[model samples]
Target: MDNNGPAYHEMMELHEILNFKTLCLVKSKMMSGLVFDQDLKALMEKDVKQTTAAIQDLQSVYKPNGGIVH
Candidate 1:
């Protein structure tokens, strides 16, 4: 980390990005239930799993400790 870490604007931007991703994850999960195609449902399941893991990683980055994985 540098002497100057992420600025307020950067943090705010990260927050917004995570918010959007979370929304997308939820919507995709909901749509997965409504979709009838087997392949599409599997894809949606994969998407949900990957997005959830990614979100956890991003949250670690947003943590005060600067991305300590646990």
Candidate 2:
């Protein structure tokens, strides 16, 4: 049995969440093209923005002193 990696368990979890957020953003953008209603399209765009901010927050967990990841 071997359990060794660069990131800690909690950090790995955050990384995974960040990946999910990114995927969701991409999927939302992709599906936006199929959204016929103007309201729904706007909602999806808002979600994309929120998801982007969420990813940034999640990445900050890995940064020192809550700084930006990049």
lDDT of 2 by residue, 1-70 (tens): 3434334556666667777888999999999999999999999999989998887777665653333344
What local lDDT does model 2 show for residue 12?
63
Clashes (backbone N, CA, C under 3 Å), per candidate, total 0, 0
Error of 2 at 28 (Å): 0.4
The global Cα lDDT (0 to 1) of model 2 is 0.76
Model 2: colliding residue pairs: none
What is the lDDT of every predicted structure here? 0.81, 0.76
Model 1 lDDT tens row, 1-58: 3645676667777778889889989999999999999999999999999999988877
Q: Which stretches in model 1 have alpha-carbon errors above 4 Å?
A: 1-4, 64-70
Clashes of 1: 0
Sum up the clashes in candidate 2.
Answer: 0
